[model samples]
Target: METPALEVQLQTLPSSPGVYQYYDKNQKILYVGKAKNLKKRVTSYFTKRHDSHRIGVMVKKIKEIKHIVVESETDALLLENNLIKKHQPRFNVMLKDDKTYPWICIKNERFPRVFPTRKLVKDGSEYYGPFTSFKTVNTLLDLIKGLYKLRTCNYDLSEEKIRNGKYKVCLEYHLGNCKGPCEAKQPEAEYNSNIEAIRQIVKGNFKESLQQFREQMKQHAEKMEFEDAQRIKNKIDVLENYQAKSTVVNPKITNVDVFSIVSDEGYGYVNFLQLSHGAIIRSHTIEMKKKLDETDEELLELAITEIRQRFSSKSKEIYVPFKVDAGEDVKVTIPKLGDKKKIVELSQRNAKYYRQERFKQMKIVDPDRHVKRIMAQMKEDLRLQVAPTHIECFDNSNIQGTNPVAACVVFKNGKPSKKDYRKFNIKTVEGPDDFASMEEVVFRRYKRLLNEGEDLPQLVIVDGGKGQLSSGVKALEALGLRGKIAIIGIAKRLEEIFYPGDSIPLYLDKKSETLKIIQQLRNEAHRFGITFHRNKRSKSALNTELEEISGIGEKTVIELLKQFRSVKRIKEASEKELAEVIGVSKAAIIYKYYKSKKET
Candidate 1:
């Protein structure tokens, strides 16, 4: 509902490109948008019905409209972006994790000092980044230090001062770390040339420095100055090595900005890659919280404008995953195939990884909400009538029909409830029968829960395909609990998930939360069952081996086995060692029996 004042104000808007801002009754900015025709764009908000609920709400809240007429659509775009960033309008896609990254600064002085800084001073000095990480800035600085002999002093290296002998060479000069520009020991021409090369290297253009070094090396080699040539070669190797690690694509793809976006329900992650000479010189991901169910194109367009301004990018061409309006001055390319497309994909991957990492951090910060979301997602994915707040998965493990065992792993609210985990010896199943083992375990688990009036799992997972699932279903039917609980089977190969009566399996996306939780349950059950089976097999083998010895009673056997851990270890023990462990009488019998058996 536009106010009478706003209606009159909107009627006066120019039919030209500009930015428009919407203000609520309190005069605070509610939204900022750009338009090719300010009058038409502003009037359309009142005339047309918005499909998005957020936009509808924003429209109703608008009380006043303000317009800034610009020279062109590009100007309007820039102004809109600036206003959004400045005011952070309520209806704008706002960057949530907006923090200024560090940059390497070359101070404006006679001999410029280089270091990392977060501030952008507008003197004659040069600043390199807004680098994604301080570690990256430090690494570049360290590499520069290793390659060049630059003065660290703050002294004014004027000709008059040097002629007057106002400064002396310092320890940095003696240590070969500095060329002593303060004392005129290093010529300004030589030092400035190094600075120029540093500038090129920082800009991701290594060809200049490499060419200079290569020419020097060639000149020295031609004059038979092998040591000087080797030094130059070493410098060239260092520069090339650093460049190789920094560059991601073809060196020919220079001076371009690449942008890619990934979005979910609530947020969009836009990743930016700045390329110079085919290397990724700068890469960053900006997270934007959606305010109006903004499309990826809208979010991406906003991000490109903001990022380009922040990083001072002047590339005439930009690469993006889709077509976008970045003003007519800047060519927007949607590369279909080849190296450009690969870089676009790489940017998208980075954005996705960042989004995943943010989700992990959110889970750590709000575990309860994370669990609830996971449960909801699982319910939707599995098509369950209710959220599977409590899930149980059963796995059977057997070794050649020896000491068969089954394990039931419990998950509560999408997390493992280790205290509720149970292991069962194969009481009803025999001879390595997985189906029967699964049936018996599932029945026993739920039947006991029913008898005790305890809660049954909302979902049951059997660690096998259709056969195992059928067996579980049969057990549920025996207890008259069929269709009361959701039962499914997971097969290891292809991760095919089978429902109780459905022949065709549901193949979950490999990256889905539903698949991850199911996989966790299956793996845990298998691990628990295998551990129990191994212990049972070891105990059975120990008991049989020791009991076969004629003089060893069960009590003595228990004591000896407890001490020595195995029958072979007990047999291998010395008479004195055995006596110290189990007493001389038992020790003597054990030692003599082993010795006679060995001789035989």
Candidate 2:
């Protein structure tokens, strides 16, 4: 690997617009970053005095540095965002929060009402807020609607009354919740004034609005209107409760971002809490299964830098539960006292809580022990360059040379990423030629990946020894991924593992947890492949007669099968039973076959 090529490219870049990529020696991308001034930003890392520990580490591993200079900064920004999304760079600040924040939209009507929305529209509708908590936003919406009796219905009042001239006062008018302009029960001017009260309430101006309500209550009390005074007092109480609940924790810091990382074994979880004016505005969480050797401090530093680059800063202080050794002049503090402490404590608690949840669900996978050992032994046994993080396994299945299907299962960080699991029907090779079927499936898979210039898996395991392994390896090499990814042949005995080079079945060391872990992984892949193959065979057998019959096409066969149940039953059915099918005829040759088969 020409590792220095990466460093040289970074050094030779001109002070102009461009994008730069950092790739490991194997050409797998570590990070994708774009810069408006390519030479200044890319070359900054090489500065002797300015070399931060993180930058130094990144520079040392720069095996291949590629650049693309765009015409403008805007183009660079767009390209940067796109590449970040496409590659999901390991070092970039990722938007861990996939759930969108909600905004309140008020229709552009004379009597507008609030609606919760995730998307912003350029239509005339007005919107406010991107509230973090659904409960908080919903409660405020209800309180305002109850107090001011603003219409909650989406019906356009102005269009109904003016354009269509169709209107009516609702029950809210009788309940004294609304100033009823529709009924003409309250003056139009009074109703308009009530609308302004709603506007003030939503803008968080409760003091001014409450003071006016208080005066109204007092005047009613002086007039000996006890019932009216009590009603106004109740409204004031509701408003006071809302204000009390909306207490700002840290007024000095308007916007603060807090981060926390919890690690268990090799897995890491990063959590972010965004606070605006001392109140939490949003929170984000990301769970990672990284290399076991990657340190917590290193992961936290990378995660923080990535997050900061993605979310624009609104606060002067950034809180982190883990100590970051970035040495940046930013206020990096573990909360010691007061509300900041409480916020940090809450965030830590949440991170731990989420970690525990993941741990519980993932307890079935004991990768830390048996699986890791098995993989390491397999690597040494196969003379692999590194421990595999991403492994793809292939297996072919069929019954008596009947239906052939292939399965591909992916394991990331020693655990099955079932999302990437794939099943393929043997297209090129038919009738249970396991070796050729494996070749076709593997070839089809890698050809597309190589054509797209995609990353190959760290290891590819075939379910058979030399024959199957050779087929898979040849396919990979054809796609120019042969030496790039490790290849292993796992031919299983009744209760043991058989490798290509070794004649003896390799039973893992009984004492090693890692060995047992690898066995479990191999077994899982076998089980998944077998399951998919069985399903394919079963479906094919059931559809065999339909596939073979000429005049009895798909639709007719489908109707006959639906009405008769199975192929076995369809073949055994009398002609009358076949004729009873909605689309089948009494004189149909297929029905005669069914009748003859039943008689025999």
lDDT of 2 by residue, 1-600 (tens): 234655577668978876788777788777766566898887765555421344456666667677788886546655666686688866554444556667777767666656788887888987666665677678878887767655554455553464454666677766766666554455545655666776666655665679888999999999999999998899999987876676456656556778888764345677777765445545666666544234577567656655555544434567876677433346777778888888877777777888777656555676365456445555654456777767888877775776677788888767789988888888887466888988899999888777888767878877877788778877877877767887767666543454445566655555444455455667776788788878676567656666566566667766766776777777676666677774445326876665566589
Q: What is the TM-score of each candidate against the true structure?
A: 0.66, 0.47
In candidate 1, clashing pairs total: 2
Model 2 C-alpha RMSD to native: 17.1
Whole-model Cα lDDT of every candidate shown, in order: 0.89, 0.68
> What is the alpha-carbon lDDT for the whole of candidate 1?
0.89
Residues 324-397, candidate 1: write the lDDT tens digits: 98997999999999998899999999999998998899889998867776786688689888889999999999
Error of 2 at 526 (Å): 41
Residues forming the 10-long window of minimal summed lDDT in candidate 2: 47-56
Reference-based lDDT, residue 444, model 2: 90
Summed backbone clashes in each candidate are: 2, 13
lDDT of 1 at 104: 87
